[model samples]
Target: MKLQLRLSEWQLTQLRQQEQNLQEEETYLVTALNERRLPMGSSSESIARRLTTTGAGVRAVQAQASRQLDQVRAENRRVKHLEQIARAAAAARLRDAEARALEEMTNLHAGRRDRTATTGWLDSKE
Candidate 1:
């Protein structure tokens, strides 16, 4: 279980990093597209074709970045779920250990001269 959790966490980290990179790539593409200047001597038909192609490229990058972001969110959710389960399991183990220790202490003190300690005076009806 611990190993699985660690692996998932590592995967989540990798996914986030990948998503960041994609976002950076998208940003750069958008910036480049925005800053583009029409060539001074270009024919209008060529200029229109160039604008169409760059617009399509920017749209494709945006779509890919969004998809990567979704994957990162999913992985993040998985890591959080695994962490919650690990915490609950640890809590259960701790409770079990405490119960066992209490039982052992009771057994150890049973032979003592103190009767109240054995009978659990704290549990008395009074």
Candidate 2:
């Protein structure tokens, strides 16, 4: 048995939307972390512990989101690289075709140089 899996255009669009959401969430988390770092004045031990736990949870999420973003960026780089390679190959093929056409034209004109022999004769007479 063989299996092939690929995302449809709609699915790809959805994935892009999800990626944007993740980026937004990560940004919000970082902003929240920054805001929470300031002195909140002396509080009871339970409140302090809750704040600490919340902070730790935010940090973990930030780390995971950052990692996921890194992965997405890496995949984008790879896709871009493959696109570049394909473009270069296409350009190379075009160049090769043009070169062949030029070579063929040159060969076709090779036998027409006999007209220059008249000029040589005129030069000798002068």
Candidate 3:
């Protein structure tokens, strides 16, 4: 019996999308971090206040993005591990099939040899 591990096309597509989303989130966080590091001293008080608000918002976004990236990485790892297991199972099945085939061939050859020997003995007595 073979164990099948199959992923649907839609499932694969969804996984690819999730990976893309993780990449986008990482890029967004990097850009936000750069913006946050920019100088705030040159701005007026009100502008500084706005910048502070924006900075806080960006920090929150960065935290969430980091968490999401971690989750995506974990999911990717799990999928890869599953794929490896499936491949190993498939290889084992192939090996088993080959071994069975070889054993059957050997048995067939032995049977043929026995028949030929019996025929030779009958001909000798005739």
Candidate 4:
């Protein structure tokens, strides 16, 4: 018996969205960091001042997004791991069932053979 891994449509969609959001946020962080590294000037000071005011908030958002991404990845891994275990268990059950069936077939054949031998002995005596 082949066991298939099944994921709900919503779960797949959510995972995709989470991945996309993480990528986008990572890009935004890189851009912001680059902007902050430019040569300091009066023009840059205004931008720097604004960045300084909102930097903590931006950092917090990035951290939260990263944490969420990690959580989603962990969940996906957990689900896949569980699926592997289920497949292995199903395979084991199938093998057990086949063994039992073979044992029963062998016992049935042996019983028939014994009956035939007994009948043959009685016929010879007669």
lDDT of each: 0.66, 0.60, 0.63, 0.65
Q: Per-residue lDDT tens digits of candidate 3, residues 4-95? A: 21333334445556556655655554554556643344334444555466556556656655665566566666778988999999999999
Task: Tell me the RMSD of model 4 versus the true structure.
Answer: 7.3
- My TM-score estimates for the predictions, one after another, are 0.56, 0.45, 0.60, 0.58
Q: Write the per-residue lDDT of candidate 1 for residues 54-119, one digit (tens) a residue.
A: 566656656665666666567667778888999999999999999999998988787574766746
For residues 12-110, could you state the per-residue lDDT of candidate 2 as single tens digits? 455556556655655554555556543356334544455566566556656665665565556666667877999999999999999999999887787
* For model 4, the run of ten residues with the poorest summed lDDT: 1-10
Clashes of each: 0, 0, 0, 0
lDDT agreement of model 4 with the native: 0.65
Task: Itemize residue pairs with steric clashes in candidate 1.
Answer: none
- Ordered from best to worst TM-score, the candidate numbers read 3, 4, 1, 2
Model number with the top TM-score:
3
Instruction: Report the alpha-carbon TM-score of model 3 versus the true structure.
Output: 0.60
Candidate 1 off by > 4 Å = 1-37, 113-126
Candidate order (lDDT): 1, 4, 3, 2
Candidate number achieving the greatest lDDT relative to the actual structure: 1
Segments of candidate 3 deviating more than 4 angstroms = 1-43
List the pairs of residues colliding in candidate 2.
none
